[model samples]
Target: MILIANGNASRIGIHTSIGDFAATKDGKTYGPLNTDGAFYNMKMLMFDTKSRPIGILVMEIPATSATSEADAARQAEALRKEVSEKIPDLEWLFQHS
Candidate 1:
């Protein structure tokens, strides 16, 4: 699974190339998506609670994309709707398959 954190997640970590990477696409490793913003920091991470540990990723998302507050609000709402509709199903498939 994937976890997105905006400065709420920070701890000891590890990075290695021993297993699967989610950003790997079309036989090409695009690496991780580094989320960056203005008002706060963002991060993306993968972990298995039952297992000891494997890998970790950190992303910083910026709130600098919007030119104004209203624009930011609108964009945020749109992105929320778009992602909320698809991510859950995608996650279910990922877990089941």
Candidate 2:
């Protein structure tokens, strides 16, 4: 849901056709979500697809001063749990670098 880039800045363009994003689990699907009016004011970090365990869109978000990589990792872990629970055989990956 939220990701932070591990390196330099770069704008990841969200186009009309972001290509094929697959879902590891049956009946499970995902798309590029809208961050237009998000209070967090985060940007699109990375785009991951569900061709494997990684569901495709891995967004890197800036964390609060108190936030740590562990926190981000926990968030990612939680997301994995939620998705896998509902999707059955879902896969995901986070690529900040």
- Per-model RMSD to reference: 13.7, 13.9
lDDT values of the candidates?
A: 0.36, 0.35
Question: Compared with the true structure, what per-residue lDDT tens digits does model 2 show for residues 13-97?
Answer: 3331233333312423322223552222121122233323433434343454215445554555455455445443323233224
> 30-83, model 1: which lDDT tens digit per residue?
222234335322222223333222233333324556554445444544444444
Residue-level error in angstroms, candidate 1, position 24: 33
**Could you tell me how far off, in angstroms, the CA of residue 60 lies in candidate 1 after the best superposition?**
7.6
Model 2 ranges with Cα > 4 A deviation: 1-57, 90-97
Which model scores highest in lDDT? 1
| Residue 53 lDDT (model 1) | 25
> In model 2, what is the error at residue 68, expressed in angstroms?
1.4
Query: Candidate 1 — which residues are off by over 4 angstroms?
Result: 1-37, 40-64, 88-94
